[model samples]
Target: MSQTSFQTPTNKIVLSISQLNQQSRNLLEGALSRIWVEGEISNFVRPSSGHMYLTLKDDQSQIRAAMFRGQNQGLSFTPKNGQLVQVRGKVSLYAPRGDYQLIIDHMEEAGEGALRREFEQLKQRLSEQGLFDPAHKKDLPDIPKHIGVITSPTGAAVRDILSVLKRRFPAAKVTLIPVAVQGDKAKTEIVHALDRADNFNQGQELPIELIILGRGGGSLEDLWAFNEEIVAQAIYRCKIPIVSAVGHEIDFTIADFVADLRAPTPSAAAELVSPDQQELQQRIQDFEQFFVSTIQTQLVQQQQKLTWLQKRLKHPGQRLRDHQQRLDELDSRLHNAIQNALQLKKTQLRASHTNLLRVTPTHRITQLKNQQNNLKHRLLLALQNSNQHAQQHISQLAQRMHAISPLATLARGYAIVSDPDKNIIRTSEQLQVGQLIETQLHQGHVVSEVKRIKKK
Candidate 1:
């Protein structure tokens, strides 16, 4: 080797602290791009920013690990200290501390048994509180007037629900209550939205009568907000009925247990409350067809009845013949009655004429002549008999009169005594002593005073 003096000129370049730190980070990240690590977690901390910081350790070594909020957001289970976990991420250096750490993108419980135990514990707690009781469930509205939705405003779930509602029942009103569908604030926002929908009629004329609380399909952690106790209680307490649609057709949550109904998806929930408009229109058309056919049938029956009645109506010739026959019968009966009456009148007149002739004036005159002759003969005999009878009767009557005469009694020496003023004599018993009396004899009367009493 020959000693030759060759001097090389140095060009110095200086970097800022950030540029130096970035270079170091790139170098360490490239060195451990893909790695699988198993260890127990320690000194675990979750900051308000949603990033996790922890130490991973084995019996002989320990290293730091971190889970950024974005990557860990979809984890089904939470990470805790002293828990064994398996992490899949890249190894990187923190330039500020120059310390090596694992940047975890995925993590799971180290054993399947541990994950199952955690799931059972959560399920047991919820079940013991009667969250899954059918008695606490409500019934779905048969006809929904307004449908309220609680979901992410920009999510596919909202689009699916709107599409189904529009096709099935376009007249129904939809109220969207936009909320976070995942993350820590999801449960709180969902509960508040449910309350608002339930009380929407407070200041309005109409309100949502049925609510759909749902989210699109995701893992258990992404859909955990609906499984929260607060969300389940809100569903139970809602005055308006609720339909729970979380995750997929096979996934269920606490909200599903307490809601009025459970649908397989957001679209299915819409269909539950609404009917197809086209189907209803088809039914109405069928009814109209049936009604028209019935009317035609009745009209046909009425026309047939009218035709039969027309055939039975009487003809003019038959009506005239019937009237003529009746008139002929009446004339014949009238002629016979007139003839009988004439014979009866003639017989009665003959009997009257014979009765008058039997007692005619000529016969009566002959009888009167006979009666006059007999009367003349009887008159002479009657005069002779009357003269003889008169003499005998006069003698008998005079003799009888002489027997009852008062003069005859007087001649027999009988006298009558009476009051002188009245000349009335009844009996001697009526006379009183010293009373004036009059004596009536056959020749004259004498008046004197009673001088003695005589009882005989």
Candidate 2:
């Protein structure tokens, strides 16, 4: 091989910036195809296009990461700034800016993940100990005379519970036991309140049958107090039925597992404890109507029997002259009274039957059929009348046509004389001497020629 043919100019080996960056990207991507990085998320930006851009940083350094819309859409939770997260992605360099970025495919909370694992472990342990057993769970009262609410008095949870209780059943007496629902003191306050409520309920003559221990929606940190073991133990030891409503529907706590019943929200807990007044009133009204109807029906039946007996009493047979004669009168009176009563009942039943039929579909259908037939007959009669008028109009038009027809004139003893072109000559002025012409009469046409012209 020639030296110059195989070798390039060696003075300087220059490369395009794009080519350099492209090779670098391929190298970086290939070297670290898939890896997991744990860091605190910062400067998270989500634009209208749905792509999430953020910086994953630790104590020393940070790197840009992008989670495209396709991968991030299935996430159960949203990522925020300063959140500890573990992300799986591929490393790549941007050719345009010569910058490196990880193309993240998945993400989850780092610190929260550990907490959730612990939560699951504790749940399993408690479940094995029969803490969540249904046999141990007491039934909620149908109508709790008094309810004790253990939560922060100033929190939205208390307001929601109070409003729902008042709306559903105003008769229920509510006692609010103020407690902290979050922070380091939240667990202790809740445990103490549960104990105090239990003591109060036992000491008082009119005891509360139900206890609602709960709070509102929040992050895992904000709701960690409910997951404390001491709070769960307190709920387990309480004699009164407890309703656990710690957060929104998605959030659950250890207290929820140990309590007699778990409601999704404080309002829902209130609803569970209180019977709806409107529904109760409707039920009462229905029962009353049913009772009254039953009583009236029985009374009517009894009245019919009593009337028959009264008739027999009013027409008692005369004192017996002979034993056989008295027996005959008694039998006759009994038969007649029974027959009258039966006849009256049959008449009333027939009236009821007729009234029932009047409201039935068959009766309405028959009535509608009669009305439809009537309308159909009227339409046919109108059509016949219209046809008759049309026929009369046609006869009048025929008479008018005949009156204007030239044949009518010929029929009246007059002939229509025309020149060879068939133009009628109405007057002698239209006639010319020696002009061939034809005369149309009533019966036939005659050929003729004008022999003379006369004016008169």
Candidate 3:
């Protein structure tokens, strides 16, 4: 029976290369959905699509990995060969090449993840303790006369800050308190630098009005000094306003939140502390003009007052002379008045004498009677002219009234027709057959009934 069954095997399982690869990919992906891998970066390549192709390797083993553009863009530091890194991704297989790889979603420097976790924890604690309270922050001087810089003396950050300060505001004196920016000594040095800058000058130099605590851009580990708790405390406790400018625009540390102000770069920090030269010049010019204008206005006001006072002022001698002149004028007026009165009396006496000689009482009475007759004739003529004017005015008024009178219009062979309700019939349509209406003529009115109507 076994020999009979061994004739042929038609049901043997077979698969094409593509099918095999696809099945293998499905199996691998399903089995290992997510995992964390740590190794040194190698064969790093970034294609035009921004997708990163790299190989992760340990001492004895290596694996291909891919970090797509979307996932890799959020990394703070640039990746390079030989750099140790940690990646979180899913296991995947490339069917076309039949190669297996890790599809990385997140990646960072190996120690950076732990540092960032610590950084966040510290930041949370500090925030809860109110170290970053706005009330604790001091306002930056409008124009800082003395600026203290805390950074490495040989680092690019100091150079950048000095250059900006020189260009923007040379008047401000910069005092450099050099400190190590990175490594084991960085945090302590930074804290000491902050303290020295805060308590600057025991009458040795100008006191620091503002402090610039900054460093150049770097990886999270390189900028760790600014993230230290002691450094944050120093910044918080410092009486002088501190401007933290560590790393690039995208990088943030605990110092940034605790300081009075945060600048994206060291140069930006310098610009923040120091006022612009051109702006100061412009302000000085404005103040100069205001002072000049104000002085000129006050001088003009005082001059006007002086002129008014001069007009009102009089000398004592001039006042006596004026009184003398006034007395003389009054004496002359009194003399003229007496002379005129005497002359008037003489004229009256002469007139009385002439009346006694040329005319009697009866003659005077006749002259008065003639004058009265003349006045009466004039009055009568005036009355006649006034009456004539009044009659003409009345005639003109009568003609004007008659011109616009309705009775006058009716007298011109036109009759006004109205309904029985006294409503004017403007058109024949207003009249209906058998409706009673009133017709107004020049002298009277007649009531009539509407007959056959005609309209034109």
- Model 3: per-residue Cα lDDT over 51-90, one tens digit each: 9999999999999999999998998778899988889998
Q: For each candidate, what is the lDDT?
A: 0.85, 0.90, 0.90
Distance from true location, Cα of 155 in model 2, Å: 0.6
TM-score, one value per model: 0.42, 0.46, 0.48
Better of 1 and 3 by TM-score: 3
Lowest summed lDDT across 10 adjacent residues in model 2 is found at 1-10
lDDT of 3 at 52: 97
lDDT of model number 1: 0.85
Clashes per candidate, residues 3 or more apart or on different chains: 0, 0, 0
lDDT winner between 1 and 3, please give it: 3
Cα lDDT of candidate 3 equals: 0.90
List of clashing residue pairs for candidate 1: none
- Superposition error at 236 for model 1 (Å): 0.8
Ranking by lDDT: 3, 2, 1
Model 1 per-residue lDDT at 208: 77
